[model samples]
Target: MTSRPAAPVPATAPAVPAAGRLAAGEQPVLPLSGELELRPWRLDDADAGALLAAGQDPDISHWNLFTVGSRAEARDRIARMHRRRTAGTGAVWAVAPRGGAAIGLAALNDVDPADGSAEVAYWVLPAARGGGIAVLAARRLGRWALDELGLRRLTLRHSTANPASCRVAEKAGYTYEGSLRDALAHADGRHDVHLHTLVAG
Candidate 1:
């Protein structure tokens, strides 16, 4: 495993409350792992903010659908992630490696409890790329969705042009479900996306 640079987060900060726990009668959100803690989003997560900023690099923005164009937008997106969790529609995880700074984010968004499924998306900072952080993070996210959230399946999609993302899905054991041609609309126009799925018992 590639050693990562030390992150700036305080080791003793209070654990953030899980989004599922925000509403009454919902299943309590459990921490997914100590190997890669799946704690709630902290308002004071300076490292997360830094990760978002790092993601705004031109290369990162080239493929990212949702771009944080400014510091204000970055703050707003973080706030919105918190709001979505409270609203019960989504949850975002800071991909923090043990004793390392937060390198990226993985999220279970577009959740549908009635269907027992959700869309999973993830990204790693430039500095954290090629270290298999995305694979580790996606595996943890899939496990938590299945074991803790009682989800039946998780789906992920990325532009067909992004083979790195496809590799991440495959590395994390998601089955290739085929592609949707001209199904995604981007600033440049329409593009194809490869869909992948992971089903759990």
Candidate 2:
């Protein structure tokens, strides 16, 4: 038998989602209560003083996973967040209360539209922690993700040492899904993590 040439392959094609289904695109700024707004981050938001202070506060330091060193670095983070939002993989919202500075932050990440899932995280200034704002922000974001973004599940992960986050999850209606033993890498060593989840109805 004679040998035959193979057919040429096509160039890399764009990702094709299943018919009638598609990845969630960029999420727009979502609003919550009259006082609290979940809004897109502005460069000026970083200059509000609270953003840099939260990065330095022990209670909220976990956000500085790589240790942002200066106000400029923090401002750079806001810029990065802007890009992330446009990319549709995440969002960083300034938790601004009416007539006040942006005193906290909330966000969604690891957005997987194929899996209909995403991860939620947040922080409040030490001075902003007691008003149940974290819980409210988490709930607002979670609802919007499940209802508007078409996500089926949302997860919340935190170190076991951070009991405050656990309370926030509970108040936000996330069920405790047990711990991932020593799964979190920390500056001091490995730490056990609590995993929580909220499934859409």
Q: Pick the candidate with the highest lDDT.
A: 2
Q: Against the true structure, whose TM-score is highest?
A: 2
By summed lDDT, the worst window of 10 consecutive residues in model 1 runs over 22-31
Error of 2 at 26 (Å): 7.3
**What value of lDDT does candidate 1 attain over all alpha carbons?**
0.72
The C-alpha TM-scores of every prediction are 0.77, 0.82
lDDT of each: 0.72, 0.78
Model 2 lDDT per residue over 17-127, tens place: 232232245446677776688887777776677667876786566533545557797789888987776666777888887656887888888877667778998888888
lDDT for model 2, on a 0 to 1 scale? 0.78
TM match of model 1 to true structure? 0.77
- For model 1, residues 1-201, the per-residue Cα lDDT tens digits are 999998888776323334454233533333434555545555555434654665566655666665775556666777888778778788887776554456677888888766777899887777768878788778888977877667778999888988999999999989999999998665577889999999875
Model 2 ranges off by over 4 Å: 1-27, 62-66
Error of 2 at 15 (Å): 16
Which residue ranges in model 1 land beyond 4 Å of their true spot?
1-36, 46-48, 98-100
